[model samples]
Every structure is written in structure tokens, then in C-alpha cells.
Target: MCVHGSNNNPDIGQLLEGLPTNWGKWGPDDEVGALNYLQAEQVLRGIAAVRQGRTFTLQIPIGHEKGEPLFPGRRPSMRMNVLDKGHYLAGKAHFDGNVEFSDDVIFMHVQGSTQYDALGHVWYDDKLWNGYDAMSTIGSMARASIVPIAERGVAGRAVLVDMARHRGKAVLDKGETFTHHDLLAAARAQGTAIEPRDILIIRTGWIGSFYEREAAEFYSDFVEPGLTFSRELVEWFHAMEIPNLVTDTMGNEVTVDPRSGVMIPLHAALMRNLGVAFAEVAQLDALAEDCARDGQWQFLYTAAPLKIVGGTGAPVNPLVIK
Candidate 1:
């Protein structure tokens, strides 16, 4: 639980067990990490690939009853809406032209559903991405909030690494781990090449389990089929310079690590150390099916997190166009 300042020399290699990081690579004041690689040319390349005007929404329903929250202390969203008739009559005001109007308010955890993790979401050795102070920089008046991500607007060429399809399964078994080797194998099988600044979307088929089992059974064990935070994967991500990674599973990586015995190491390593963002709980089944039908795996993907200042994360509705 050691906290280091921006200029302090923290033993990150020892902490991550020889895994190097990109801290200070962008700059001392840099909040946007690997995302800086997303250039105008990349966006143009993504748009140029759109032969068909088909679009897919990669976000789950905000209040999906079947898909419950997997993380503890994160509850389902609650929405309360008042009908136009009840509201208009209650307000004692006559509508001018449109007599009916409805209003609703929602309250829920940002990470409870399909969401984007801000750069300030994770920290290692008491420091955040680019050596930003974790403690003092994530509150009411802090740096590296969701504003930068919102301002940048994640739109680029996205490649889907369909793990379930590669394994020939509807859904991966619980506790199964997809490693770096598997990622490359999946890409090779799909005839796709990993590119720099590409938005990587992984479909584990874990969300199918949520629909198959009861809510209690689905969320009880906290076990899932997801990527493994292996040193090989970290090295590959660094080498490829991927901007963001999204997965259908709640946690991007398997919760129980058999190798290092560390939990959520990918979160700390990617977000905290390398400043790579993550979009969790993505709904990729529809997109995967469409890609399979068209034999086109690459698409133009865009996501914009809520512009909540000082917010750690925000629910997102990502759009993929082909």
C-alpha cells in the first residue's frame, strides 16, 4: 500500500513482477495515456472501412433485469418516470401544443453496467497513470477525470477478437482464462491483424451465462471467463500500442489469477501504470453475429463517457458501424 509522488521512484517493476510500464512516457502532466495514439488518420481509416451503413449498439440495457451487477456494492439502476397525464394534471398547468410530457430520473453506479473506466480509476504504488497523485487527484477537484476522455471521444478502427467463436462455444466456462497466446490465435483465425491505436473489443461470451442462469446464480460466485493479465499480454499491448480494450465480462481480466495470485492485475497494470482505458460489461453478441455474417470484423467504433467532472467512470453506449 505504498503511495509515491509523481517524481518519486517507485519500484513498479518489482510490484508488477518485472512488467514494465509507460509512466511519464506521455509526460508528467499527461492525463490521456495510450489514447494519444488515436489520431485523425486512424478515424479516417475506420470510417473508410464502413462499406455497409449498418450500426450496432454495443451496450446492454441500462436496467436489464437478467444481467445483474457482478461487482459488490454496485446495485442495479433505478428509474422513476412520471407520465405526462399525471404530471400535467398534478402541476395544474395546461400544455400549449403538446399536452403530454414525461420526466425520469435514474440513480445507479456508473460501473454497474456497460461503462468506461477513466484514467483516474486505478493506481499503483500510491500513484496513478503518468505518476499523478492518486489520493488527492480523484475527488471533487482532481485531475484526470472523465472530461478528457469525453473531450477526446473514442472513435477509431476497432477489431473484435471473438474468443467464443474461436473456441466454438456459445459461452466460455467460468474461471476459464484467455491468454495472450489465445488472443493472437483468435486474430489469426479471423484473418485480422492487430494495429496500433486500434480499439480492441473482446467477446468472452460470458454475458450469455447471465441470460442462461438466474440472477443469484449468475452473480453469486463472481467467477467468469475473461482475459488473463499475463506478462506476455502486457508486453504485446505495449508493443502494439492499443488505445483501449473492451470486454463483455464485468472485470476485463479473470478475478482469480493462478499465476501471480493477484486480483484485477490488469486494471492496475493497464489503467494505473500504462494509462490504457477499459470498457467493461460490453454487449458484443449482436456485433459478433453481424460481423460473422458479413465476414467483416473491423468497424468504426465510437464511445463517449459522461462529462462528469472528477468522475472515475461513466456508463457508456458504444456504437460500432460497418
Candidate 2:
């Protein structure tokens, strides 16, 4: 028999029965005092006992023609082809040598698509997370570059929060945003629970429609659905103590912010403050469908970023194993 929390027959009483007797009376300003008062260890152990086991994986291709405009007018990629090459040895006998042949040489210059941002990629107003300056963190002549992240590949248990299914679609459409409540509701609907040390992979299904258009039409505009994380959401993830986050969009945040005039507070808070890692431009359509059909949501997630020396960001091929 499986022991779990259910939306229909929710154990509401059991869920809140352990609340501290003095919950309402506890002072909000007392940080250390609060820690001394709560049963933190016991609560954590209880949560650990009920997690389910299931597997699903998502794949994100790094070089999509539809992603060209992500850099806004920059050439998407370039390739140099080597037509032919021949090598001859001097000490040869039937005219004396064997001819060495080489085929076409190709180099990929990547532009749009999902990528991993190095710690050195962005600085907070001028100060980097670990005290490295922008100049020291990136290359001077070559542009913003950081050490390769492929050397340290990302491997973790993944949890999927299907925002698109909750909204009744394969695509979330441009300009739609997901809230923290939507995430919790989706997990509840899927019969799974999130835990610490997990890699949270949110699927908004924005990338699914990329291939519907012609190559030129797809590359003309770069727009996709994304999630909007509130400060509350950030705090929740921090409290959950997850190692990283991956999402099926270019960046995790929604494209526009009405108040800040900037689009990425979640990135600022997660990367700059919490030091959490993130994978962007994920492909989640297939994975979302699988989870919807099976009602299972965990997966073994793996991703390897390109090993570009001192690169700000590098393309990745992320895979999920069941």
C-alpha cells in the first residue's frame, strides 16, 4: 500500500496537527529564538518518509533554427568547412608514401537556445558572487567568458511541475506566467511531493510549437512561455534546499515585469543570493505528456554543458533517464 497525501482525501488535520502550540504568538523578528523553539528535525524526518519513486526525463537540443533571434539580431551560428587535405611522407617507396586524407572540418558558432550560465557570467552591479571582479571572471579580448561547466556535469534527481497540463494545453502561449500556487496544485494533481536536494524542472511547454513554422518564420521572432517566481517562491525553494532548477524556456522568468521594468528577479535571487544553479532552454513537451498519462513525476536528470574556456554560457544537451 502506498502512503501519500491526496487532494481528494487530504489529511488536513494530520498535516497541521503538529504546529507549535505557540505558533501565532511567536515573534516574527526573532530569528535564533524561533529556531530554538520549533521541532525542525522531527518535521523534516516525517517529510522524508512519504516521498514516491518514479522516473521521467527531458531533452533540450542546444542548436535550434527557431532560436536564432534570442540574441536579438546577432548571427545565430557560423560554420567553416574544410574542403580537403592531404599529407605526404618524404621517405616513401611506390613514389614511396601512403596518402593521408582529411574530410571537411566544421566549427559550430552557437547563438540561440537553452544554455547554462557560469558563475562568472553575470556580476551584481560589479561584484561577483565569490568575490571575483568582472574583469577577472571573464576574458577581456574575447568578451564575457567563464570556465567550462561541462567538467562539472549536473546530475540529480528531478521533479517536474507541469504548468501546461494544469492549464489544459501543450503550449502555455506567449505572455502566460506560472505562479507558485500553480506549481503546488500541479504537484498535488500529479500525486508527487517535492523534497530537498532535488532538481526542480518546471515544464511550461513553450518550446513545443517551434517546429510548426518555416525556418525563416521561426527564427524571425523568439517568444515562449515562462514561469514567474515570486519572492515567496524563491523562499520556498530555499527552504526546500534544492541544488538546482531547470525549466523549458529560455530563462526561468516571464518575459516582462510590470513593476521592476526588468524581467529576472528570480535569476538574481537564485543565482546571486542563494548560489543555486539553473538550466534554461529545456525541452519538456514529451516528458510532460508522459507524466500526464502515467501520473508519475520523478526522473533521473543529466546534462553536460559545452566545455568552452572562460565562456559566459554554453549550449547543453540535457537528458532524462527513467
Candidate 3:
């Protein structure tokens, strides 16, 4: 079924009633959510895990000609040249210093590329993370915007749970789902364990497939195959103290819940309630392949999102150093 056409979905508020929450766990004014778990100690731990000194940047190019993978309504970034050789040749521009440079402006969402979502990105029942009022997001994300996340930054040990590789497929089928148990199994198979507060990066090979297929074929029947929400899965994340969730998919989880027909309950169940930070649309193909080859699944993960004030989210290119 299509993501938007969920047949008789349950009330998200009622559907998520009584799920565990981290509201006020830090303080009444807290904003960065579980990323607060990444302190100096976590940074040191990340450094310790870096043995090979290999660095991989995990972001897709912003302005791909074939078009970037995006959610249904969002459009790809468009870059327009304001100053370039053409302008200079047209005699519309001249430099006294004989220096010419190209300048362009990009028009796109703050979440247009690999991005880190603010705690207030989504909510229900008139509240965001840390019990902030839902109305605080009016006009801009007046509260719990991505600024705090960008300010603090994220650096820590991360485990790559290559779900697509674990399942012996180049890409998981559309709408395929996995849970905490599956994550554990995949980690075991990869010869690693997901430690507490670790940045959890999962690969479905979904984003990698975009380069190999047409945008129409990719967006067709676009129920992204990914983690399915469950009480046990939520509890596992809380128990593990996971600081961030990174994935190659757009929504980061199965686009629509099959049983409840709810679209991305994890956005509410984990992010809104439990304050788990989300990094979506990451490019993880090369990293996953190397991890599989070397069996080095744990690495140093670092990301610094642009400090866009009042932004609901901001573009980021996370680094994985092994």
C-alpha cells in the first residue's frame, strides 16, 4: 500500500499512549535529547576505536542531475549561478584585482540532503521533546530547533548494522521490516556488539539503489523497507541508551506501519517521546562494503550539522573513521 493512503490508520496519540518517554529526563529546558549522552568520554571512546585511520564521508551529492532521493512532497536542490564565467564574459561583471570567482545559491530544504532532525521535527498531542509545547514550532522551530544539536555536535563510537548485507540482498524489499532482535542478530553475525549510547547506523542499501535505478522506479510504491516499531524495540533503544539513529532511508523506518497503518510511529514513539536523534538519507554503501570485508563494524562516528537557527533540521555529512 502507498504511504499516504494508509487505510483507516489508528490515532497516533492513542496508538502511542503509555509508551516510555524521556521528557524532563534531562531538565525542563533540555533540547538536544539523547545526544546529551555524547560527552567527552564518548569522544575518547570513538578515538580509541579508530585503528585504520580511514575516513568515509557519508553524504550524497546535493545537486545530482538525475535528482536526489526525497520524500514525496519535497523537491531536489536547485543551484543557480549568480556570478560565474558567463557573467564575466557578458561584461556584466568585472574585478579590479583580475580575480573572478563563481557564486551560486541553493534552494532546498534544510533537510534536503543527509540531515539531522531537531527534537521538535515531529510531535503529537501538542508537545515535543522534554515536554516542550508543540506550538513552540510556529513560524520556525522556536524551541528544540537543530541549533543546539549543531552546537554540541556528535562524536562517539558507532556500530554499523548492515541489515541489507545481513539478509544477503543488495537491497531489502520494499516495506520489509526488522526489529531490535534482528539488529542484535546482525551485530552478532558481523562480529560486533552494540554498546550503550552508541550511534546506531543501519544500511538497507536503499539509497545506494537510487544510483542504479530510475527515480520513477525508485519512488514507485515507496514504502521504504526499514525498522518496524514495537514496544520491545523502543525499550531496547532506551535500555541501550542509543544516542542517534542513522540510516540510508528517507523516513528512517518502514514508511507506514502495516498493522496500525500508522506512518512512522517511531518519529513519535522514539523521537518525540524518547528523544532519539535521527540522521536520515545517509550514503552508507562504501562503508557497509568495507565493514563486511574487514569485519570491523565499530568505528568513530562524527557529525556537525549546520547551525541554522530555528531550523527544524539541518543538512549534515557525517564522518565514519575506522
Best by TM-score: 3
TM-score, per-candidate, Cα-based:
0.90, 0.69, 0.97
- Residue lDDT tens for model 3, 44-68: 9999999999999999999987778
Identify the leading candidate in terms of lDDT.
3
TM-score of 2: 0.69
Model 3 lDDT at residue 108: 94
- In model 3, the runs with Cα more than 4 Å from the true position are 1-7
lDDT of 2: 0.56
User: Would you list the C-alpha lDDT of every candidate in the order shown?
Assistant: 0.80, 0.56, 0.91
Greater-lDDT candidate between 1 and 3? 3
Model 2 per-residue lDDT tens digits across residues 17-84:
33222212224221111122113442343334324444334444434555432433434544443433
Residue 264, model 3, lDDT? 89
Model 1 accuracy (lDDT, Cα): 0.80
